[model samples]
Target: MNGILIIAHAPLASALRQCALHVFPDAGSALAALDVEAHTPPEQTLEQARQLQQQLGMPHTLVLADLFGATPSNVAAKLVDGIHSRLLTGVNLPMLMRAICYRHESLESLVSRAMMGATQGVVSVAATAPQNQSRRTSHDQDQHDHQQ
Candidate 1:
């Protein structure tokens, strides 16, 4: 299985990891996080990331970062060699959760699934009132309601 590593600015990386774990309690072994602290040098962050990658101990890894050109992403870009691991920016809870769910798949497939989750998870909610919508019938029991 491919392991997942989250690298982002302070708090964001760990926050994403905790959210993923909340839904997947047993996934802790395959997931890791590295929060780059303020004033930390890129070289130091990269070294720390390398340690986390090693601790993940999987044949392949998928690294997620919060921003593309930020310190986290910069460290991750150097951390992955493109053979055993890959990096994806704009890490959101949806993307991390999707990656964890599909960690058993090939790395390439996992990356595709994660991207799909990230894009599909974002939507503009309608402003209609609850009273304006029709109620679900017994036949709709199998359908999942995504709204809160």
Candidate 2:
């Protein structure tokens, strides 16, 4: 199985992991997180990442970081270059959740699935809502006219 790791600036990595565990309930062991603090030396952070890699154990791990060029991503990039892991940036709840749901798949497949989730999760709702909202608005106006 490919273990999952999330790395991001302070709180975000852990925060996302916490939310994922809340949904998965049994993901505490399979999924790990590393939160990068401003003062934390790169070497120490890299060490922790090494341990996380061990904790996950196995063929590979999928490491997700928040920003591509940020500290969290940079630190993670260092450790995952090893054969046992792969890294994807711009980690989000949707991607994490999707990955957790399908963790048993191959790392490459999970990467594609999770990436789709992350990309699709980012969207803007139409300025005008669908027909349901329009109908509700019309009904509300009719009620107001009746009261008058």
Candidate 3:
């Protein structure tokens, strides 16, 4: 199986993993860490990721990061030249779950799927509503009844 590296900002990795577990349950297989607070240091994260890639014998590593241009992302960037890894920014539960589910996929394909999952995860409730006005009204009524 391909390896997954989750590097998030501010210790959010643990929570992200929990969310992933909630979605996938059996997804406790990949490697991940939360280093947004500078606990592990960027250099250490890079080394660890590289070591994990080597140990897992995966052709490529998929790194899901919390923010773009942040420390975790930058650290991942440094390893790009030496390892077959893809760095994705703005990672969320949907993206992580998707990556883990498709971990065995090629690096390029996994990255594309991850991006799509991330994009689709972000949606306005109104946008998800039925196009028919009556359906929307009924939906709103149901929501109101549930609140009462």
**Cα-based TM-score, every candidate:** 0.86, 0.82, 0.73
28-144 per-residue lDDT for model 1 (tens digits): 999999999999999999999999999989999999999999999999999998889999999998888899999999999999999998998898985543776875656765665
lDDT tens per residue, model 3, 1-148: 5677777776687788777777777756565554556667677777876775566556678877888898878877776653478788899888887888788788888889999999998975533434454533554534642211
Pairs of residues clashing in candidate 2: none
Best candidate according to lDDT: 1
Task: Rank by lDDT, highest first.
Answer: 1, 2, 3
Candidate RMSDs in Å, in order, are 7.1, 6.3, 6.6
RMSD of 1: 7.1
Better-scoring candidate (TM-score), 1 or 2: 1
Predicted structure 1: lDDT: 0.92
Report the backbone clash tally of model 1: 0
Model 3 lDDT vs. the true structure? Answer: 0.73
TM-score of 1: 0.86
